[model samples]
Target: MVGGMHQRKAEMARHSDCFIALPGGYGTLEELLEVITWAQLGIHEKPVGLLNVDGYYNYLLTFIDKAVDDGFIRPSQRHIFVSAPNAKELVQKLEEYVPVQDGGVAKLNWTVEIEQPPPPPTPASKQVGFPALKKAEIAL
Candidate 1:
């Protein structure tokens, strides 16, 4: 009974271990929503994350919020999707995701946890061999 779309869903369903979604078009939205529906139905358990580079998904995330407020979606559904500004942060969020049970849905905390931050850069004053220049004086 699995058609082309079902086959695609199967591919996604098979990989229900780790999920990462990047900014995309209609196909991306459909994939994300279907996976989330499966999660809500207790058919799969996975960590789903969004890599929102350059504010791409800002509006979509907000629309999901509106969906919840308008009673078209449940608040617990928010746990199925998370948005991160970059790849590293997205991975970190996925790793730290904690699943919670609501009704029959597997929900994540949705609180971002940042780890493995890049080392802080050395301040200019602490760097060796750079002569400090006085403020540039301009001729009138």
Candidate 2:
């Protein structure tokens, strides 16, 4: 098993050329958002997709559209992912996707910047420790 979820996610993303989120619960949503976020940050150029599967993701897709309308998400950024009602369509969409040179430049009236937040303060009572383990102990 993977040592942790975060590490597993990173490994998966690194190995993947594209991402397709199937209909699932909270974990699925979280993973989908994380990959999209990484794409937004210019960390990866992979195409992300959603297999709608009987319109399961319809509400979520609508929410994303609402976010764009509310100025929270730029219209161009919406193209970061594509959705289709079935696996074949989604796969075809993904295969046809081409990464834009400008990283999907949004015609927004504002600028986007990466902000670094200050590190969290460590508690005085807790002691940080590292454990030695074999690489095979973790798998994604």
Candidate 3:
């Protein structure tokens, strides 16, 4: 087994060219989400897929659709991952995926302008109370 959970995930992500999620519980879901987030952030160009055997992921798919409808997820961003009913189809979809060129243009900028507040004045070193400790005094 890998030495640590994060180390395992990093190593997996580094070595993987694609990510697929089979029917599973929380760990599986978490891994799927992490890979998808990495793709969204341009950390990697790997394809992410879901194998929806026996309609196992139907509810999750519906939830994703709801998210898109609710505007929490952009419609273009929905193409970041693919889903299919079986292994063969899912794999085929992954094999055919082409990464989006520029995270897709945002449908709306959604910027809000508010009255500006002035920055807080910086406190002097003397006002901080304690003196800086030696490097050795700090524990890891």
Each prediction's TM-score against the native? Answer: 0.67, 0.71, 0.70
Please tell me which model should have the higher lDDT, number 1 or number 3: 3
Which candidate wins on lDDT? 2
Q: Against the true structure, what is every candidate's RMSD?
A: 19.0, 12.0, 13.2
Q: Which stretches of candidate 3 lie over 4 Å from their true place?
A: 1-3, 104-140
Model 3 worst lDDT run, 10 consecutive residues: 106-115
Best by TM-score: 2
Ten residues in a row with the worst lDDT in model 1? 131-140
Stretches of candidate 1 off by over 4 Å are 1-3, 104-140
Residue pair clashes in candidate 2: none
C-alpha lDDT values of all predictions: 0.74, 0.81, 0.79
Question: Which lDDT tens digits does candidate 3 get at residues 6-116?
Answer: 567877877888999999999999999888777776667789999999999999999989999999988877788999998889989999999765645433221333435
| TM-score, prediction 3 | 0.70
> Which is better, 2 or 3, measured by TM-score?
2
